[model samples]
Target: MIDTVALPRPYQNYVYAYPHKTAYRPLTPRPAIADLWSGESTSTLSLYLHIPFCEVRCGFCNLFTRVGAPDGLTGRYLDALTRQAEAVRAALGDTEPVRFANAAFGGGTPTFLEAGELTRLCDIAEHVMGADLRAVPLSVEASPSTATADRLGVLAERGTTRLSLGVQSFIDEEARAAVRPQRRADVEAALGRIRDTDIPVLNIDLIYGIDGQTAASWRLSLDAALAWRPEEIYLYPLYVRPLTGLGRNVDPVAAEHDWDEQRLRRYEEGRDHLLAEGYTQVSMRMFRRLDAPPQGPDDYACQTDGMIGLGCGARSYTSGVHYSFDYAVAPREVRAIIDTYTATTDFTRAAYGRVIDGDEAERRYLLQSLLQADGFSVAEYRGLFGRDPRDGFSTELGSLAERGWLDDAGSDRLRLSPRGLAYSDAMGPEFFSPAVRAAMAAYEHR
Candidate 1:
């Protein structure tokens, strides 16, 4: 039940609910390694290892990764990462017999590494971290040019269940417009290779709102992606941010309104098309085939479980704190951070992060859960904190209810209507604590 007349327009901001890393500051005399992870549940943990090297830097890209590493830089980085992993393992030291339920390798492009290097990367995850790659669900991201036979072979041999490829657009002109260079033939070849490997699930990423993209062109891309019968498809709205190649060339104020409307129209079109094609909308961005196997741990919830992130770009999450190495978008800053990461041998304690108080945690819980189509369970929230969400976020909930965002059929659980989901970008930031907002505002984004 949505009030179409009162629907809010999309506010292009951070798509994810959590605070951006720019707000993170270095901790002086960092806390003890053991003390930071003490008494946390290890039964179902998520492991993330970052590979910050990519073959090319796309125009719209702003992740904490850099372009191709020099000849010897990759080796040095792997050596440092292995050392850091060993240290992290030693720090955990028989801590309730740690078990990893899900793991992922994310980066500028994990497949950017050579086949031998890919094997070594898997070894680091399995041997150094003590997570059995074969026993758990593993996911890896790849680009069209790097998804070669040898690389896919290594991934398949190492028990990678999901292979996510960034196929932003099938049209060469549109790809170039987005600063992603790839031919349609290259993308098709990569898709064939991925299917040949029998990787179980293939996720294709597509971006809407690119410059010059139209409804017809968008449908063409969708049809091309659907032909692959991918297990999952992610439709992203292009955002031009400071420091990105696209950000520099465009005038934000001049194009904001038009771009916002275009994105909304395209998002709705894509969502409806996918739903008609037997795909379920998991979130605004994620659409999964009905037949695809479950991807993550069923019993593990990110709000409660601890996550261990290794390498320069990875961010580790504990019960009360989330930390990572320095975050940057500018090429010079990113290179410097990567260089420092490769030179370091210590990886025991957090270097930069923020402390999450009870209020922050509650806000995170609500934002993360409500952004999804399934919403959240009121009873579960009460069990976790001994209070209902309505008790603490009554104002926010009431506002959403007044606008007909809440589902009318359910009283035990709270969920967003289709229109509310479309306005998630605006709603998520509204729940941010004043302190976090101030901290994020104070940090200079490169």
Candidate 2:
């Protein structure tokens, strides 16, 4: 038995990516994009195209997107993406065989673009970037109003394997409370249209915590999503972040006092419900139907592969560095960044990013794997680092074991207990290196 240690708050941060973008700062002398990828393995790369426009900003959202695009802005953005893609493809070099394992279109909402624009976007990915959309698992995010038949048709014809719809709540009242506006009827209609397409997977996004949410209301939303028998589902806890509609309107002290316990209850309820319905939990936020087609190559590990991202908000990751352009949440600042992106002609250098040293990389690998349902193989970590994880992360591992958060059944693999999985948001931050935490702390939130 290990000595007990105090546990941190369960909802402190969402560890979506290691060394969050906030830690990124301007490079002193920008590195040439070509040199960054020089001699790097090009096998199993991921391609991402970001569209940073949405119909209406959600109250609880702080994503780097504006409410709507100005006239001609969409066309200009695509033009810029084409330029960036060309630069990136050239940077990858001609001799090395660059093969993309999967691709994604994410944004304020990719479907917000018109059908013709969507077609052009795919053209850039295929013709300019040399990524065959039909040959890879292409996931795109959509909203109820934007998931029109034409848009869905364009996506289906271009080989979109997955479409994630952001239906925050099936109840209009709850949606309003969460600052999302939509009717259940419209949502169901959108689902019907989505199903009409040959897209193999439909992923519905739902939120569990809101001002007036209760267990009964949470069930309604879950049941409504289940009615469609979506291939996947995501249950996100509502977070009142700075620079968002909810953040501006809600009382912070009250939210802080009330949210954690309430969200935990909702999460457990949702998790158990999905498990009973024959779905498997992929991460803290993702659940997949047992019978859904294989999503991607099982060998693709995000921690080790390189990703090529095009767009102001998309981030590209290489073994030594993760980089992106200027980021902001405020409308004015976001627009300024996008304007700068559209005006950019030189896409050959990385101007803003953080380097991944040996220590940081190990932390990232461990943190990313531990959060998944099937924890990573200890032998794999040992092979990469030339040392056991316990040697480097003994304090953290000990604390987790003391809390009964670790599976003690074996020594060859590192797995989280059910109780530990429930505290993923808390556990993730515990692994943030001191330098990353300091950089993130010093970042100025717009």
Candidate 3:
């Protein structure tokens, strides 16, 4: 068993405000003009289809989803999704060629669908996307139990290069205790089956900070995870949210370790250990193959530019604006997610997709680069912003550099120091728009 680290409540940076929060932004500029725009038109795009059914809901999970969602209606959902894709293509008109540069299938568990239904979903998407999906990174999320040789074979055949298996924990005892059904052996077998196919990347999702979790136990699990040598590892600390089993399990007073800082420390320790083993930390909580060169502004730019989304609770972006209407369409909750995604996009005709104005663009540009890896390429920033970022964010950049959080190679690139990585996410957004900052600040208060 792992030893649990207990902390006093006061040490938790119980700040009245955490002071770091920002929205997603694409790194590259989109060629969108309001004048001649008639329909969706973008060359580089990503695809994300949601599978809303799950065998059972995990204790600490919060994504737009449903459990025991009707699987019989999957065919209809596929039809609606294809219509949505076609609508996207038609909106862009017949002149522009729509291309899918990247694609991902998320879910309750994408494998929740039967084999044939899954294949049809991908087939229609490929037809509407108008391009070979193999040319780009493709991913699908699956739980341990639902994965089988047949299902994995289908996924691999359909261009899924990455598999993010939901292996929240390897401790079968605790796993069963959490009301989440998982078998240690099953997770291993799923990985084996997927590996036998063409999927190159196997990402395991590890959840820490469960009610009865300890560092030793978590580390032991990490050792077990590392033994599998997955191409990527995503570590998510357990969090309690409304409507989740964790919410019911959470007892502030009764819980032994609940301080935010302590939770964060545990994460940092895991991160450092993983890095020691030659895994490169990519996105937040995501460590990937050491050989996978860091994704630069270019990758983030393409993803943020324009993409189509489908299934219940998915979001799509067009020309820097976001619209999310993918709801399960349950006769009762149909209006819930629909009203939010459709009505909001229609009314606002806007979103914080990118920093549009030159000045705001510069601020966010620095913020994003730093937030990603506590590093920003000075040259790239100059090329995009049309001005030196050091000059653009002269004061903040200089202050951070002076504080040792920022590093520069005489203007080629900038990266955060080891200490800087600790506060990069929260600190980057302090300079963001007040509204955005305030909204994120509210999270800490909660």
Instruction: Give each model's clash number.
Output: 0, 0, 8
Ranking by TM-score: 2, 1, 3
Of the candidates shown, which would achieve the greatest TM-score relative to the real structure? Answer: 2
- Model 2 per-residue lDDT tens digits across residues 236-323: 9888888898889866666464578899999999999999999998888999999998765534579888899999999999999899
After superposition, candidate 3 runs with Cα above 4 Å error? 1-41, 176-179, 248-258, 291-304, 326-367, 387-404, 407-411, 428-432, 437-446
Q: How many Å off is the CA of 427 in candidate 1?
A: 1.7
The candidates, ranked best first by lDDT, are 2, 1, 3
lDDT per model, in order? 0.86, 0.91, 0.62
Looking at model 1, the pairs that clash are none
| Model 1 stretches astray by more than 4 angstroms | 1-9, 15-17, 295-298
lDDT of 1 by residue, 360-430 (tens): 88888888888889998999999988898888888888878777677742487889888777777777777
TM values, all candidates: 0.96, 0.98, 0.77
lDDT of 3 by residue, 1-446 (tens): 11232212322221111122123333334333232234545666677777666777777665555565453455655666666656555555556666667788887788887788788777866777564656667788998888888888888887777888988888987687666887888888887787788787888888766656678888888888898788899877666654556666666565444445666676787888899988987645678868753221224253225656665456565543444433232323543543343323222122223333445445545665665663666777767768876676677666566556654536577776564555454455445656555554444211
Q: For candidate 3, give the lDDT of residue 8.
A: 23
